[model samples]
Target: MQDHISSLNIAPMHSPWIEFRPNRPDAQARVLCFPYAGGSAQVYHALARGMPENVELGAVQLPGRWDRRREPLLTRLSDA
Candidate 1:
């Protein structure tokens, strides 16, 4: 299996939140993946289950979508 997938560090203007499924601890390495624009970390919910035995999958859930649907959507990519 690959050594890693993807990871990102987001410092939001306000509070940020993260979520994940149950995970087991082992000698395997952990990988965090980020989704593309309009994408959400929930998409990777299965990653923790379908990932290789030696790899851990984690996803990033950015605000402004599903959870923040009430929030205004940004049009310009840079504005997001």
Candidate 2:
């Protein structure tokens, strides 16, 4: 299990829109979360704290938030 977890990659990408918090790569399931309206991926940071060691958590960041300041806020629901 440790080996599998160690093999997981959590590097920040160039987009700066996706935030990943890998707790257990060996886990059978991964939990992916989407940020709320006008919110950034970091909004889920606290929620990841109580996740079991066997569960991996990933947060998705949208434009116009956090590091994506240059991006325009999504106005249409279809864009989400």
Candidate 3:
């Protein structure tokens, strides 16, 4: 699992918000996945693998979790 994750070419758009796992610049579509409360981007790893090559899978890295643990969580929808 570590090897697979490390091999991905991550392209983070606004680092705090979205992360494309193995970015596909010419993908025909994109899917943004959000984790359950208190969950992290890792939740979408398996899903990303199943995605078609023409579709990009992006995971939302909410604040206060995982690598963003140091950041404060969003209290309002507008802040997100």
Q: Which candidate comes out best when scored by lDDT? A: 3
Cα RMSD (Å) between model 3 and the true structure?
9.1
Per-residue CA lDDT of model 1 for 1-80, tens digit only, reads 23243233222222334444435344245566777888877788876778766555666666676676677766776854
Q: What lDDT, from 0 to 1, does candidate 2 have?
A: 0.70
Q: List model 3 lDDT by residue over 1-80, tens digit each.
A: 75664456544344567777767776656789988887998889888888888678889998888888898988998887
Clashes of 1: 0
TM-score of each: 0.50, 0.60, 0.73
- Candidate 3: residue 17 lDDT (0-100): 78
Could you give me the TM-score of model 3 versus the true structure? 0.73
Task: Give candidate 3 regions above 4 Å deviation.
Answer: 1-15
- Model 2 has how many clashing residue pairs? 0
Task: Give candidate 3's whole-model lDDT.
Answer: 0.78
RMSD of 1: 6.8
Best by TM-score: 3
Clashes of each: 0, 0, 0
TM-score of 1: 0.50
- In model 1, residue pairs whose N, Cα or C atoms come closer than 3 Å (at least 3 residues apart or on different chains), thus clashing, are none
Residue 25 accuracy (lDDT) in model 2: 49
